[model samples]
Target: MGSIATRGDSKRSGNQGMIKTHSRSRHKRAQALAEMAVMVPFLVIGMMGMLDLGRAFYYQISLTNAVREAARYGAQPYYTGLSPACNAIPPATSPGASCPVPGDQNIKDRLAQELSGTGFVVDPTKIQILPDQGTRVSNCGTSGSCQYALKVTATYQFTFITPIIGDLIGNPLTLKTSSLFRTEY
Candidate 1:
């Protein structure tokens, strides 16, 4: 009878040890959940920041390509007539005075067209044509002949989706790109 009572007591002690192990595992699980809960917001914000950065980079590349296209278009010779009358002009004559160069509005239109479908609201006012219209002239040595170059510049305001990061830095960051090309006339 004494041996039987001792065996029952040992069994009860073993059951108590199992309960302690189960409770410890539960506590560890709860601690892991608490840690995850504390870190989730930061992880989410970091992901959002990365997304915004990628968006900004995309916008910048698109803007750069648009500017380059606009510059290329502006630099090319545009002849409206069947025959190129501008090509026969005297070497001493100024190209801007006789040749038909692409106006600022035309360049802006090309830029806008390139930027279309990009989800960017391009302000026409933000586009700048250097040397303006009817002034495409650069003095070339002492020959008195003019060399033409077109420069197109555009600026876009890039707003981040992450408000915290935007606020920490500057909201609506200005992204500007410019392209220069010599005339093919």
Candidate 2:
């Protein structure tokens, strides 16, 4: 009877050890979960900031390309079948049947169209054709004769999606791009 009692005591101690190990494992799992909960918000914010940075870079490139295309278009002389005509002044009226040829208004239209593909709503009012309607000569140097160039400028207000970052740097940022090209006619 004494031996049987000793054997039963050993079995009870082994069971108690297993129970302790199981509880410790449970505690560790809980600790890991608590740590994850604390870190998730910070990770999400960091990802959002990266996203905003990428968006801003993409938008800036798009604006630059659009302005460049518009300036290039404006620098060329319009062909009128008989000869290449360099129109010094753009039509004062709005774009319609009155202004059929490619001019300053057309340049603005092309810029707006290019920006439309970039997921940005372009305001026509923000597009500016330098010299308003005509070409200007710059970089004359000692030659006394300068090359004709056209300049196009555009502006857009970019809004940030990240609340914290937006607050840190004004919610809506203003982005501007300009391009100049020499006349090819």
Each prediction's total of clashing residue pairs, residues at least 3 apart in sequence or on different chains, is 0, 0
- Model 1 earns a TM-score of 0.82
TM-score of 2: 0.76
Candidate 2: 10-residue stretch with minimal lDDT: 90-99
- Residue 70 miss distance in model 1 (angstroms): 0.4
Put down candidate 2 lDDT per residue, 1-185, tens digits, no spaces: 99999999998998999999999999999999999999999999989988997898899999999999988877754544332222333223322122233567788888888878788866889888876553342232443323356678999888999998788878788889999886543
- TM-score for each model: 0.82, 0.76
lDDT string for model 1 (127-156, tens) is 999867756643333455554667899999
**lDDT of all predictions, in order shown?**
0.82, 0.72
Clashing pairs for predicted structure model 2, backbone only: none
